[model samples]
Target chain A: MNGVNIGVLAVQGDVAENVLATQMALEDLGIIGTVNEVKTPEQISDIDGLIIPGGESTVIGTLSMVNGALKKIKEKIANGMPVFGICAGMILLSKKAKDRVVGEMDQPLLDFLDVKIERNAFGRQQDSFESEISLEKIGISKFPGVFIRAPSIIESGKNVEVLSKFNEKIVAVKQGNIVGTSFHPELTGDLSLHKYFVNLVKTKH
Target chain B: MIPLAGDLNDAKGIIKENIGSFGTKRGTSTLKRGFAHMLKNGVVMDVTTVEQAQIAEDAGSVAVMVLDKLPSDVRKAGGVARTASIRIIQEIMDSVTIPVMAKCRIGHVYEAMVLQETNVDMIDESEVLTPADETRHVWKWDFTTPFVNGARNLGEALRRIEEGAAMIRTKGEPGTGNVAEAVIHIKNVNNELRRIKSIYDDGDHQDLISIARDLKVSYTLVEQTASLGRLPVVNFAAGGISTPADAAYLMKLGCDGIFVGSGIFKSDDAKERAQAIVLATTFWEDPNKVKEAQKMIDERQSMLGLDTKNLELRMQERGSTA
Candidate 1:
C-alpha cells in the first residue's frame, strides 16, 4: 500500500482544522497518510491528495491566481489528482457560481466539478443551520452536516451525482474523482465523509 | 528670573513624567488608536473579492469582509469561506491607511499570529462564519495585539472583556438577517444590571463586587453599567444587522457601536446603507432621524451570506483557552 500524503490548501480559511480533521480521518480509516498545509505551488506537487478547506472563495481564488497556484492546481486536477472542495473550496472547483450576492464579482474557478453554485441561498449569517443528510449514494446515512451561510448546487453535469440536499437544496455532489460539499462535513465530528474522500484518493493513486 | 527658569524646567520634567504615566495607563495605545480610527470613519463592507474590498474602500467603507465569492454564488456553488490570503491582506492594508480586519476561527492562534504580522489593525476573533480552529475559542488575552470578540449576552461580553479583549461585539447570529436576538440580549443584560443596582446604595463597591462574584459575573459589567453608571466596556453588536434601523436599535440598546458584516455590503445599495448605518449610530434616539436614515439604507441594498453560529459553537466548545 502506498503511504498517502494529503495536503490542505492553507492560504486562508479553516486551514488548521482541516489539517487536524484530515489527520484524524486518516487515523480513523487506518490509512497511512501524512497531512500538511500546502501554501505554495511547490507544496501542491508533493501531495497525493488535496483538501481545500472552507473559507472565502474570492480571496482564495485571487490568492491562488497571484501566487500562481490556481493554474498549477488545475493542471494537477487535469492530470488525475484527487481533490476535495468543501464549501468555498467547492465553489472554486465548480464551473460557475451564480446568484452570487456580490453581483458579478469574477472568481477564477477550477472548472473540475462541472457544476453551478448559488452562494448563500439559505440566507445570511444568522440563518446558518445544521441538518442530518443522507448520502445514500456514498453509503452515508443520517450524517449531521453543518451549513453556515452555505451555498446550494443549482445544476450539475451528467457526470455529477447528487449526493445530498437539505430542504431540497442540493448541498453535496460528486463528479468522478472530485467531491464537493456545500455544508461543512469537516466541521461536524463525522469522519465517514473524509474517509469516503480518502477512498477516492486511494483508488485514483 | 533665575528661580522662574528652574521652576519652568521642573514643570517640563513633571509633564514628561505625566506623559509616561499616561502611556502606562493606556497599555495598548497602539491598538486603541487603530480602533478609534474605525469608530470615527471606518465602515465595514461586505466583499467577495479583493476588487470588492478595493471598491468598498473607494466608496467610503474603511474595511471589507472577504467572503467566499458572494451570496449569488450560493445557488450555484454553495456558501464558501471568504478568508483573505496573506497577500490579499497585505495588499488591502497597503491600499488603505484605515485598518483592515479579517475573520479567524476561534483557537486558531496560528492564523491570529499570521494576521498580527500582516499589519492589520485589529483581528475580529469573529465567529463571523467558518472557523479554522474547532476546538478552542480565541481568547483575546492569547494574542499580543488588541482584538474584538463577539458576545451574545452580558455574560459573554463580560467574559471577553475579562479575557483582555480590547473590544466586544454581540454575536449577531450569522445567516439569520435579523437583529431581534441581538437587541433582546443587550436589553436583557442592561435591564438585569439595573434591577440589581436599584437595591444597593451608591458607593457600595463591596456589595456590588460580592453580588457580581456570587453571580459569576464580570466585575467590569457591574462597575460600568450597574455600579459606576456606564455601559459595559468595549461593547459592539454584530450579526443580522441589515438596515439603519437595526443599527439604531443596537445603539438604543446601549451598545458602544455596531459591526455591519453582511448587512450593508450584502444589500443592493452598499454605499447608502453604509452611510445610513453611520448616521443611525449618531442619531439613534430620534425615530424621525432613523426613518430618514432608513431611506438612505433602503436605497443601497446588496446580498451576502454569513454563518457564524457553527463558529460560535466551535468557540464555545473550545472555551476561552486560546
Candidate 2:
C-alpha cells in the first residue's frame, strides 16, 4: 500500500504522539505512507485519513473551529475519509458532548459520529489511570488503555461498533470509516489500533 | 476508587496505584509522561484569581496554574511566597472546565500534600515561591499527583525527572517580563542534549557516563535523553514571557509548549494579550499568523520588563542543585 496520507489535527494537543505512532504503524506493516500534522483546511483536505490526538477538547475544538479546520474535517469525514479520534478528539467527533461535572459545555464538534460523549467521564486529571483492555475486533488480545482526564461514550447510534469497554463503560467504538477511543493508544507502545487504521486508510486510498 | 477524607497520611499511594502499566504496574512512567504528551503544543497560563482563570480558559490555555500572586507581584512583595489558599484553588477549579494546577514552595512536602488534597490536576514544585528546604526538593514519587518543575539546564531537568517530575520547564527569570533568561536556559538544555545525542550516536558509552557524573545525574537518564534526542518528559518554556513574539520564538526553539507566568495579566490589555499569546503559541511556525497575533495588541499595553542584570531575586537559581 502506498500514497495514503494521514493527518493528525494540530490546532493543539498531542499531535506529535499520534504522528509518531502512525509512522511506527506504517513501518510495522511495511506500508509506504506519510503522516503530516495538518491544521489548516488546505492541509487537511490532502489527507486520506485523520487522527485527532487526545488533549483539552474545548481548546482543540474551539481553535480548530476558529481556523475553519473543523468544518473541513467534518466534510472530509462525511465524504468517507477515515478518521480516528482519541480522548478529547473522540469528544469532538461525537454528535453531542457534555462535561461530567458541569454538564452541557458549549464547544464545537465534528458531528460525524452519532454518539453522546461525556467530557471527563472518568473525572478530573487526578482520576486519570490506565487499565487492561481488549480491541477484540481489531485482532488485539490485550492493550494498555492510558486514560488521562479522558472522555466516555455514554450512548451511540445503532450503526456504531463497540470495540472495547472498561468497567462496563464504552471506551472504544467504530462506525464505518470513523473510529474513536477514549483511551490513548499512541501514549502506550501498542501499534495494533494504529496499524488497523493504517490498513483501513491504505485500503480506502 | 476509595475516598480519603480529612486523612492526608493515607492519601500516599492511594487510588489503587496499579492502574495498569502494560501489566501489574502502579502509576507507571508511561502514565505520568503521557499526561505531559496530552498538553503538547498548548499554552498553559498562570492565574491568580477565579476571574483570571476564566480569562485563561476563554483564551484557550490548556491549563491554568493558580498562584498566590502574579510572579511580578510576588517579586514586588518580597515576603515568603507560598501556595495559594485552598479556597481560591478550589474556586478556580470549580469555575473552569480545564485542568487546574497550583504551585507549592520548592521542597515543601506539606504544601504539596495540601495542594494534592485539594485535587488540583498537577502540583508545581516551583522555585518562584520561597524554597522550603535548602538542599532537597520534595520526593514526588511518594505522591500520586503529577508534577512540573523548573530547570535551567539539562542536569537539573534530569534530576527533577529522576525525582519524578512528569514535565520540565525553563527556570527563566520570573517577574522580569524578559525572555532572555528563558532563551538562555532552553539553549543550554538543547546544547547539552545535542552533546549527549552525538555521544550516543558515536557509540561512546564511556563518555556519557563521565558526562552524567559531571551533570550529577544518573547514567541511565543521560542515555535515555541522548537516545531520544529530547527530554523524557515534555519541556515547556516558562518563567519570563510577555509578548506574542516571545512565545512564538520559544516555540520555534523546539519547546513543546509555554507557561506565561506574568505575561498576560501583568500587561495593560489582559484580554487581548492573552488571546494573542495563545494564537502565537499555537501557530508559532507561521510568521504571517504570528504577525496577525502581534498586531492584536498595542506596544504600550506590554508589561514593563525589568533588567535581569540588576535583579536581587534570581528565582531561577533557587532549589536547583538538589
Candidate 3:
C-alpha cells in the first residue's frame, strides 16, 4: 500500500506515545505512513485512520466536542474511517459507561461501538495491574495488557466480536470498522493490536 | 492619587529608548510584573460546569479553570483528566468573559494547541491528574500559545516562566487538599529572591545568571530575561488552596492569583467559600477583611483528607524521576 496518514487525536490524551506506537506498528508491517498529531476537526479529515489514546474519558469527550471533532469523528467512522479507542477512548466509543462506584453518572459517549462499559471497573490507580490475555481468537497468542483504572465491557452486540478477555470481562472487542479496548495495548509495548488496526484501515481503504 | 499616567508613560518611554542602556537581561522585569499582578487580583474557581464559570466571573476571578471533574474525583478515578467536557468548555466560554483555562497531561502540547484555537484564554500545564505521558514533564516553550504552568517550588515555577510561559503558579499538590506545601514553596521562593537581591546590586545580570545556573534553578532565566527588560506577566498559586484564608495567605506571600480545583465545590457552602476567596485575594492586607474572610472560610471549611507529608514524598519521588 502507498503511504497512509495516521492521526492520533491530540485532545487531552496520550497523543505522542500513541503516535510512536502507531509508527512502530506500521513499520513492523512494512507500511509507510506519516503519524501526525491531529488536534482540530480540520486535521482529522486528512488522516486515513485515527487513534484515540487512553486518557480521562470526560476530558477527552469534552475537549473533542469543544474542538468540534466529535461530530466529525462520528461522520468519519460512519464513512468507514477506521478508529481505535483505548481505555478512556474505548469508554467514549461505547454506547454507555457505568461509573462503577458512582453509578449512573451520565457521561457523553460517542456510541459508535454497540457496547456498554463499566468505568473504573478495576478499582483505583493503585489497583492498576498487568495481565497476559489470549488474543488467539484474533489469531494472536499471549499479549500483555496494562489495566490502569481500566474500563470493562459489560455488554456487546451480536455484531461485536470479542477479541480478548480478562477475568471473564471483555477487554477487547471489534465491531465492523470500530475497535475498542478496555486495557492499554499501546502502553504495553505490544504492536499486534495496532498492527491489526492498521490492517483494518488498509482493507477499508 | 496623583495622575501618575504621564510619569509612568515617560518612564516607560525612557525604558524603551534605553533598552540597551539598561544592559540587563530578558526575564527580570517580566517576572517582577507578573509577581506584582498576581499579588493584586488573584481569584480561584471550581470549574465543574459552565454555571460555575459564571460564578467565577461574578466573583471576579482573573482566570477560570475548566475541569471535567474535581481533584477528589481525579484521585478516585486514578489520576484521570476529568475536567469540563469540550461541550462544557464551549458552554463555559459562552457564559463568561474572563480567561478560560483547562488542564491536560504534561507534554500534551497538542491538547494545549487545541484549547488555544478553541479560544481558551489559557492552559494550565499542571499535574492535577496523571499526565498522559507519565514519563515526562510537558515543556510549554515549544508552542506559540501562552501557558500557565504549576510549580512545586520557586525553582520549578521560575523555570516555566523562563520557558516562554506568560504566567507561573505554585502547585498545591491536590488529593491531600492542604495549603502547607504551597506555603513552603512561597517561603522558599521569597527567601531565595531575597538572597539573590542581596548578592547583587543593580546591573549585575551576569552574576544573577551564574547564580541561577549554579543552583540549577529556573529563576535564573527569569533574572536574565528580566535584565533584558521583559516584564513578567502573571503568577498564581494552585493545588491545596481551599479557603479564603489560604488564598489570602498566598497573595500575601507574593502569588499573583490562586486557582482552586476541589477547594471551592468540594465544600458544603461552595458559593460562600468562593465569594470569601474572592474577597480575601482582593483585600488581602486588611485585617478586618481578613477576619470576615476567616469567618466565612470557617463556616464552609471541612477537614481535607490530604496527607501533606505523603504528597511531599511523592513529589520528591516524581522529581527524581523527572
Candidate 4:
C-alpha cells in the first residue's frame, strides 16, 4: 500500500496546527501519509495534496512568489492537485478580493478559485467569532467554524459547490479539486474536513 | 446559513451581538493570552506612521508597534517620550489589518487605558518610552488589553509576568540597532532558566522561596517557571535587532519571536529588510535558508548601529530603577 504524501505551505500562518490535524485525520482513516512543510517548489510538486493555513495573505502571497513556490503550485493545481485553503488561504485562492469596509485591496493572490472574496467580511480582530457551520457536502453535519479576521465568498463560478454559509454570507466553497474555507476548521478540533481532503487526494492518486 | 444584512452597519451589529453572548471561553486574561499566543514565531515591526504601518504589513509583519518616534530618535530627542498620538495611532489602525500595538511609558496606566479604548490590539509597558512613574509599573491585570513588558533577566521576566504581562521581551537597549545587548539579555534569561530547572530537579523548595523573593513574584509562579523551563507566557527577542542574521540568531537561541524597531524603516531598505527578517526568523533553524534571506538585503543600506556602552539612556535598567 503506497501512502499519501501531504504538504502544508509553510510560507506563513497556522502551519503547525494544520499539520497535526492532518496527521490525526490520516490516523483516523487508517491511511498512511507523510506530512511535510513545503518551502521549496520541489516540495510542493512532490506532495499528494497541499494545504494553505490561515495567516496574513499579503505576506504569504509575496513569500510564495519570492520562493518560486507560487508558480509551481499553480501548475500543480492546473494539473488537478487537491488543495485546501483556510481563512487567508481562502482569500489567496480567490480570483478577486475586495475589502468589505475599504472597498478594494491590492494583495498578491494565487487567484486559483473562481470566486469573489470580501476581506474581513465579518469584522476585524476584536470582532473575531465562532459558530456552527453545516458542511454536509463533505459529510460533516455541524462543524464548528472559527473566524478571525475571516473573509467570506461573495460570488462563485457555476462549477463551484457551495459548502457552508454563516449569517447568509458564503463562507466555504469547492471549485473542482480546490477547497477553501473562510473559517478555520482545524482550530475547531474537527478531523472530517481534513479527512475529506485526504480522501480527495487518495481518489486522485 | 442565516442570511446576513445587506447594510454593512447592520452586519457589524449582528456579528457583535452574536459574539457577545458566548463572550469567549474563560475570561479577559485567557482571551488576551490567546491573542499573544498567535503572535508566536512571527515578527512585530515598530512603525511610526500610516505609511510605515502599511509597509510593515505589506512586508509580512505579524503586527505593527505604533510609536511617535523610533527609540533611537526618542533617546536622541531627550524630552519626555509618551504614548503615540491618538490620531496617528487611529490612522495606522485604519491603514493595516494586522494587529496594531503601541507602547506606553512605564507605569502610565492612563495612557494604557487610552490605547485600550482606542481599540489597539495590545499595549506595551515599555521602557523604550521614558518612564512615566519612577517608582512603579502599570498593573496590567487591570486592563482588558494584553500587555507585553521587557526583562533583562529571568527575575525581571517573572516579575513582569507576575504583574500580569501576557507577553514578555528582553529589555535590550532600544534604538541602538545593535543586537549585542539583546543577545546578552536573552542568554542571561536562558542560562537562568537552566539553573532554576536544575534546582527544581533537586527538589530544593527552600531555594525556590528565596528565588521568588529575589524576583519579587509569587513562589508558585517561580516554581511554575522552573518546571516549564521557560517563562509561563511567550518571550520574544526585542531591542537592537537590525539584520536578518540578528533575528535568526535570536530564534536559534530559542526565543519565541522577535520585535524589530529602528533597525527596519530606519534602514535604507525597509521593505526588503522587513521581509528578509520575517523569513529568517521563520526559517532560523536552516542556515542555507537564512543565507538566502541574508542575500535579500544590502549591508550598506542597513541601519547605522549605536554602541550599547555609549548609550546614555539605558531602557533595560528602568525595571530596577522603578
Candidate 5:
C-alpha cells in the first residue's frame, strides 16, 4: 500500500489523542500515512478517512456545521470514505439521539449511520468505567473499553451491523463504510481497533 | 495538544500499567482522564439554579457547574464559601442532560464525597471558594468522580495531576469578570511547559530532575509532561471569561475550553451571552465566525469587568502549597 491521508475532525477537543492513536495505528500496520487535524470544508473533502473523536457532541457539530465541514463530512462518508465515530462521535453519526437524563435534545448530527442513540446512557462521568470487552470480530479479545459519559445504540436499522455491546446495550455498530462506537478506542491505547479503521481507510482509498 | 509520538507512547504505557489497580475497576485514572477529554473544546458554565443549568444546556454548554451563589456574589457576601447544597446540586443535575459539576472549597474531601454521592459528573477543587485547608488540596485519587483543579503555572498543574486531577483550569480571579489573570496563568503554564520540553529534548536528565524537584512534583510526571510538551490532561481557561471575544481569545491562546461563571448569568442577556460564548469557543480559529458569535450578544449587556491588580482577593493564590 502506498499511503492514505487520514483526518481527525478537529473542530473541538479530545482530537489530539485520536490523531496520535491513528498515527501509531498506521505505523504499526507498516503503512505510511499522514494524519492531520482538519477543520475546514476543504480539508474534509480531501481526507481518505475521518475519525470524529469523543468530545461535546453539540460543540463539535455546531463548529463543524458553521464551517460547512459537516456537509462535506456527510458527503464523504456517504460516498464510502471510511469513518470511525467514537463516543460523542457515535452520537453525531446516528440518525437520532436523545439524552437519558434530559430526554430529547436539539443538537446537530450528521444523521448518516441509521441508528438511534441514547446519550449518556451509562449515567454521568462518575459512572464512567473501564472494562475488558470482546471485539472478537476485529481479532482482539478483552479489549479495554473506556466508556466516558458514553452513548448507546437504542435501535438499529436493517443495514446496521452490530459490532460490540456491553451490559446488553448496543455500543458499537457499523453500516458499510461508517463505524461508530460509544466507547473510546483512542483512549485505551489498544491499537487494534484503530489499525482496523486505518486498514478500512486503506482498502477504501 | 498533539505531542511527540514517544510522549503518546509513554502515556499509553502509563495507562496500561496503572489502570486496573486503582482501588476498583469502576473509576480508574484512565476513565477519569478520558472523561475530561470528552469535555474538550466545549464550554462549562457555572450555574446557581436549575433554570441556569437549563439555560446552559440550551446554550450548548458541555457541562454545568452548580454553585450555591455566583462567584462574584460569594466574594461580595464575604463569608466562608463551601460546597453547594446537595439539594441544589441534585436539582440542577435532574434538570439537565449535560454533565453537572460542583465546586468544593479547595481541600474539602468530604464535600467532594457528598457531591460524588449526589452523582455529580465531576468536581472542581476550585479556588473560587474559600479554602478550607490553605496548605493542601484534596487528595483526589481517592474519589471515583474526576476532579478539575485550577493552576496558575506548570508546577501547580503537574502537582494537581500528581494528586489525580483529570483536568486543569486557570485559577483566574473568579467573579471579577476579568480575563487578564486567566491569560497570564495560561501564558505562565505554557512558558514553563516549553522550558521543560526543551530540557527534555536536550536530554538533560539532571536538569529535568532538579527542575522537577523545584516544581515539587514527581520526576516521572515532569518527564512525561516535558515529553508531551503540554499538560497531560485538558486545560481550560476559567474565572472572569465574560464575553464571546474573551472566550475566543482564551481558546486562541490554546485553552482546550472555557469555564464561565458570572460571565453569563451576571450579564443582561444571559441566554444570548451563554450561546454566543459557546459559539465563539467552538469557532475561535475563525475570526469571521467569532464575529458572528460576537454579534449574537450585545456588549452593553456583558458583565462589568474587573482588574486583577485591584481585586481584594486573589483566589488563584489560595489553597496552593506550590
Candidate 6:
C-alpha cells in the first residue's frame, strides 16, 4: 500500500487517544497513514478507514444524526471501508442493541454489523474491570481488555467471526471490513489491536 | 455453548459486592485521577435542578455540578449561599448517569463529609459558595472522594494540589457571563509555568525551593511541576463561559476542559447552547468548527450581562495571594 488515511469519529468519546493509538499503530507496523478526526461529510469521505470510539452511544448517535455524519458513515461502511468500533461504538455498529438494565433503547445506530448486543452488559460504570482476552484470528495470544460500561455481543450471524470472549461472553467480532469490540482497546497501552486494525485497513485498501 | 464455569460465577459475585461501594475508602487517588482524566476536552455544566441536569446529560456534558442558585443569582440575592440541599442533589444524581458534583464552602469540611456520605462522585471546595473560614481550606487528603479547587496562579494551584485537590479550575468571575478573568488567570498560570520550566532547564533547584515556600506546597511537587511544565492534576477553565466562542478560547488557551457555570441553563436555549459548548470544546483547534458551534445558538437570548468591574464581590479574589 502506498499510504492509508484513517479517521476517528469525533462525535464523542476518547477521540484523541484513538488518534494517538492509530498513529502509534502505523509507526509500529512501519506503515504510513494520517489519522485525523472526522466530524463532517467532507472529512468522512476523505478517509480510507474509520474508528468510532467508546462513549455514550445515545449521545454519539444523536449528535452524528444531527450533524449529518451518520448517513455518510453508513454509506461508507456499506461500501466496504474497514471500520473499527469500540464499546458504545460497537453498539452503534451492531444491527440491534438492547440495554440490560433499561431494556431496548430507541437511540440511532449505524446498524452495519449483523450482531445483537446488550449495552452495559458487564455492569455499571463502577462495575468496569480489566482482564486478559485471547484472540486467535488476529495472531495475538493474550490482550488486555478494559471494560468500562461496556457492551456484550449475544448473537452473531454466520458471516461474523468471533475474535475473543470473556467467560464465554462475546466481546469482539469481525465481519469482512468491519470490526466491533465491547471493550476499549485504546485505553490499554498495548497497540496490537490497533495494529491489527491498521493491517485490516491496509489489506482492504 | 462455550462451557459451564464456576470461576465466572466467582467473578460475578465480586462485582455484586463491590457495586456502589465508594464510601469505604475503596476509591484511591489513582481511581479519582483516572475518572477526572475521562472528562478532558469535555464540558461540565452547572445545574441546580434535576430537569437542568437531564438537559445537561442530553446535551453530552461529561458531568454536572449541582448548585442551589446561579452564581450571579447568589451574587444578586445577597445572603449566605451554602451547599445545595442534599434532597435536590440526590434527585439530580438519580436523574443522570454522568457524575454529579456538589459545592461546599471553602473550609466547610463537615459539608464535604456529608456530601461524601451521600456518595457524590466529587466535591468542589468552591470559593463561589460562601466561605466558612476565611483563612483555611478543607484538608481533602482525608477523603476518599476527590476534590477540585479554584486557582488564579501557580501558587494557588500548587497549594490546592498540596491539599489533595485532584483537579483545579481558574476562578473566573462566576455568573458574570464574561470570560476575561478566566483568560487572565489561565495565561498567568501558563506564563508562571514557562518561567519555572526555564529555571529547571537551567539546573537551578534553588529557585524552586523559594517558589515552593511561597506557594506553601512541598518543594518536590514544585520541582515536579516545573519539570513537567503543567500541573500534576487536570486543570479546567470555569466561570463566565457564556458562549461556544468563550469555551473554545479557553480550551485553546491550554485549559484541560471547561466548566460552564450558570452559562447554559440561565441562557435561552439551554439545550442548544450546552450542546454547542461541548462541540466547541471538543474541536477547539478548528476555527471553522468553533464557528459552526457559535452559529448554533442565538446570542440575543444569552444570560443578562454583568460587568465584572461592577460586581460587589470578586469571587476569584477570595483566596488569591497574587
lDDT of 2 by residue, B1-322 (tens): 1111112233344356443333333344565667777888889999999999989999999999999999999999999999998999999988888999999999999999899889888898999999999599987877777889999999999888877788899999998999999999999999999989999999999999999899888787788789888887889999789999999999999999999999898998999999999999988998999999999999898988998998999999998778
List per-prediction Cα lDDT, in the order shown. Answer: 0.62, 0.87, 0.65, 0.81, 0.85, 0.81
Candidate 4 docking classification:
acceptable
lDDT of 6 by residue, B1-322 (tens): 0001101122211221232322111333443444555567778889999989988888878789999998988988978989999999988876676677999998898999999878787899998888888688887767767789999999998888777777889999998999899999999999999999999999888888888898777788788788878887778999999999999999889988899997898898898999999888877888998999999999998997788887789999886652
lDDT of 5 by residue, B1-322 (tens): 2221212222211222233332225566677777788788899999998888888987889899999889999888987888898989988877787788999888887888888888898999888888888778887877778889999888898888887788899988899988888899999999998999999999999999999899898888899889888888889999889989999999988999999989999999999898899989887888998899999989888888777797788788996674
Model 5 residue B44 lDDT score: 96
- Give the 10-residue window scoring lowest on summed lDDT in candidate 1 chain B: B1-10
Residue B61 error, candidate 2, Å: 0.6
Candidate 4 stretches with Cα past 4 Å from truth are: A131-136, A139-144, A188-192, B1-34, B37-41, B133-144, B158-164, B192-234, B282-289, B292-300, B320-322
Native contact fraction per model: 0.00, 0.48, 0.00, 0.07, 0.72, 0.02
The 10-residue segment of model 5 chain B with minimum total lDDT is: B4-13
Superposed Cα deviation of residue A183, candidate 6 (Å): 3.9
lDDT of 2 by residue, A80-169 (tens): 999999998888889998888777878888887889998888777667887788888889889987888888889999999999988778
**For candidate 6 chain A, which ten residues in a row score worst on lDDT?**
A122-131
lDDT of 4 by residue, B186-215 (tens): 999999999999999999999988998887
DockQ for each numbered candidate:
0.01, 0.48, 0.01, 0.27, 0.55, 0.21
Instruction: Give the candidate number with the greatest TM-score.
Output: 2
Q: How high is the lDDT of residue A100 in model 5?
A: 92
Tens digit of per-residue lDDT, candidate 5, span A2-79: 579999998775888899999999999999899999999888888899999988887788767867999999888878
Sort the candidates on TM-score, descending order: 2, 5, 4, 6, 3, 1
* Candidates' chain B TM-scores in the order shown: 0.71, 0.93, 0.77, 0.92, 0.92, 0.91
Candidates' chain A TM-scores: 0.96, 0.97, 0.96, 0.97, 0.97, 0.98
Between candidates 2 and 6, the DockQ winner: 2
Tens-place lDDT per residue, model 1, A1-205, is 6689899886545565578778888888888878898866898988889998775565566656755778888998998888999887999899988644444335678988888888766643323444556889999877866655567888889999999877677889988788998876665567888899888887777
Quote the lDDT for B286 in model 5: 84
